[model samples]
Target: MTGIEAINVYCGLARLPVPALFAGRGLDPARLDHLMMTERSVGLPCEDPVSNAVNAARPVVDALSPEERDSIELLVTSSESGIDYSKSIASYVHAYLGLGRNCRVMEVKQACYAATGVLQLAAGYLASGVSPGARALVIATDVSMADARAGYAEPATGHGAAALLIGPDARVLELDPGAFGLYSYETLDSARPEPDRDIADVDASLFAYLDCLSRSFADYRSRVADADWHTTFTRLALHTPFAGLVKAGHRKLTRELTGAGPDAVAADFAERVAPSLHYPSRVGNLCSGSVYLALCSLIDHLPPGAPPQRIGLFSYGSGCASEFFSGLVGEGARQALAPARIGERLAARVPIGFDEYTDLLAGNSRCLLPVADRDIDLAPYERFLTADPGRGRLLVHRGTKNYHRTYEWV
Candidate 1:
């Protein structure tokens, strides 16, 4: 019963449509058809990794009973957009969320796969019964550094975080006990050598992702007997760098496992996989949070009294690790998720144009600066903050003073 007690996402306060970005970059318009995305979130100058992480988890924490909040014994922040080499992002997240002093706080980084790894690890801790009734929090937060320089990849990059509250309750998603598979190796498919610089060999990344999917599923099949790819799960949610990638991955998997052709694969995809792409299509890629976003999207489709569903999840990270796992969405998942208002908040996101997007890149690039002192100017983006203030208390980075990052609620 140790699994997701709750889940939520904060996809920032603004978005840039893909078409606007492509036109702004002088890229081929036809590329848009291949991406199958509508827009991407833009991390405001006042929103850094810390702010994004806190904002994402704040609502979930607020909903907890004080006793439930105090029961949170572990907090793990996963991201590649870390601000300091030595200070774990979990430190800031712990302070902002006001967790107890006895709790363990740490961070993990393995590209996009980090969050899923920590989640399983955390779930294992809960299932261990060493700390009875204890809860764990995992926040996968990252800021996008994409600009025109990234070409088409720029429009698909995204910002923000997804939060998971895991415990014995398992109200949202219940992990299938001892049913998982993993695969890992090293490759230069993608790398963020510098804080602001991202390098990716697209062909290599694609190959690695697809390769990991097959290998990991093979490992999964070994552990769980009679785990039919077509029948084991009612729905599928995979790490979505883009909607097109998920569709292609599903095609390959369907053909490999069931010998399905184009028409069958398309029909199966629409039924099992497409539901998961709704949020990812709009928010672009949230790094480690992307797959969870997909999960959220799929669960969002659960009707008022839908039956419990088994879901298959696949996560892949560059430089490179992957996992194939399964979970059951509780019958009340849709009710548990309603407070997040994912779609409503997304609709309220202020849409910025090409020129404003170009202006935003300057701020986006400096998000991970190691400078000892700096002040972020939120004055320029005041409208975004004011547009939907009632959504909830939003967190923003005020500045860094004497190497300490400061934040204020807006």
Candidate 2:
């Protein structure tokens, strides 16, 4: 109804290395009996979030031609960690990816809901026709929450990155009408200082937060009950701050909506976790990227012919805002997702020692040393970097991974 064209999801091909939780930290990856795995990972990669983003975007950029790359309208990045107080990460990505000067860029903040917001915004942009190319690239990347030994985000704490190229085309997921709601008046479930945050209690409050959303869901359902609707969704994907949160929220909402007993509801929650289904057990709460990861996991693991597969996307941001939206997994959804390629990447990663993980986390640049360009020669893509400290510039191609970031100094 919005006259919006298309919203294609082009997942960039790249991965962060898993930190040394296996070797240096005296931890065992095998112990993660209920965690999720990416297409691939490297521990050292987690140290620099910027580099992680650049790495993820490289393959996707290479996939496009110079003209297409130059036509990019915007690069919306969602991250709780802003590279600097004032300087936006969009500038860095625009330069690193070799986009034109006309590219409009901005960073989104709202915890894990930021990326989802980008998707929503892109839909609005497509509804308008001012830009030459109706395309928006949304990228989400976060290293492991600095500390690994503690918290629910642990085990989930690993470095990872994912990218989606959104545009108006007939090839991707189409935005359906009447698909969004914002849950307001809810208290912040988790909040931390801007710098040096300690999210020890972030996941601890998930139940409470889900409870808040469930009440809103109930009200919405009551309002919609009068309209006879035959079609229903196949899956419900939440901005998963933690794996257990999915069960808690699903149970609470299902019981209220279906009138099932606690036992029945509990069983339903367990049923959602299929054997082949790999949840985000390792990547922790990647803020805005959580829901996207859930979608990716379901698409990557679900069996073919899984019908009635409507996905419910839940986005919750502390301070606090929550939303519920749905997407239809059309007949061609899996084919467009390129599942085989994503699966291959996840299967090819190398594990690292926790010490090496910490070392990568402690990444930085030498003040005296000049910025050097990295020689990145990957297939179907050319990589280049330029640094201008004189203008406080950081043009980098695999520059340095310091303080858990690999941002190119452009």
Candidate 3:
């Protein structure tokens, strides 16, 4: 009886067209047809991982009754963008959200899969009944380290966060008991060995993703009775590094499990998978939070007053950890998440051309650096900040003082 009670995302107030970025980087325009992404989020210098997490979770937290808010017994913040080695982003998120001090707070790493990893653990804890009525807040937030060096991935690498409130209520998604799979190994498909730099082997990453999708589902089938990839779930969400990757992964799995011809596969994808790609297509990859974004897209796409449905989910993180799991979305799921206004906020994001995006890279790159002291020149980013809809509640990083990160509400 434990699963996601609510979910929301903070995708920044700016966006860059993928074509604009491709042209700026001198990449082949033809590749856009394959990427399946129209735009990517652009993070301002004043915004960092901590702020992204807080901004995303604030609405969800504030919507809770005081009793419900105090019941949140755990907070886990997952991110690849770490500002300080010893400190976890949870510390900042916890303080900003004003959660109970008794809550268990920690951070995790494992590339994009980190959020799902911790989410499963949290669900188990809540279901154990030792702390009856306890809830957990899981936020997967990251800033893009992508630039010209990342090549095509640079355009797909988005910046934002997804926040989920997991509890016994489970209005949004209810966990299917003991129906899951896991796969992990060591391979350097992608890594951020140093701050402000990202290196990735696109080919290795893609292969690993598709490979994990197939194997994880197989493992899941072995555990669950009468599990059929084609019929077990009505809708599916795979980690979307880009929409095309999800399409490719779906094609691979659909082919193996059903042996469907290309035409059937295409029709199945358009119905079950394409709805999940809408957010990824707009905001690009959300790292650890990517799959959740896909899930949000899927739920939001549901017609109002639709019947309850089961959803299949796949999450793959790059130092290679992955899982395939199933959850039930209740009839009120979409209405429960409506307060977040994810789509409206995303549409409100101001569009930035190639020139402004190119200028942002330098400032955004410094986000993960462990510098002793610096001041963010928000003066240059006034437009992005001035008209923010969540102005007072939106947390933003001011800079660092003696290596101490500072943040203030916008």
How displaced is residue 293 in candidate 1, in Å?
0.4
Q: What TM-score does candidate 1 get on C-alpha atoms? A: 0.99
User: Per-residue CA lDDT of candidate 3, range 332-388, in tens?
Assistant: 999987777788888888899999898888888888888899888778877788665
Candidate 1: 10-residue stretch with minimal lDDT? 145-154
Off by over 4 Å in 2: 1-47, 65-71, 129-133, 148-150, 170-172, 185-188, 192-194, 202-204, 215-231, 262-279, 305-309, 353-410
Candidate 3 regions with alpha-carbon error over 4 angstroms = 388-392
Ranking by TM-score: 1, 3, 2
The superposed Cα distance between candidate 3 and the true structure at residue 299, in angstroms, equals 0.6
Q: What is the C-alpha lDDT of each candidate?
A: 0.92, 0.53, 0.92
Global CA lDDT computed for model 3: 0.92
lDDT of 1 at 105: 94
Candidate 3, poorest ten consecutive residues by summed lDDT: 385-394
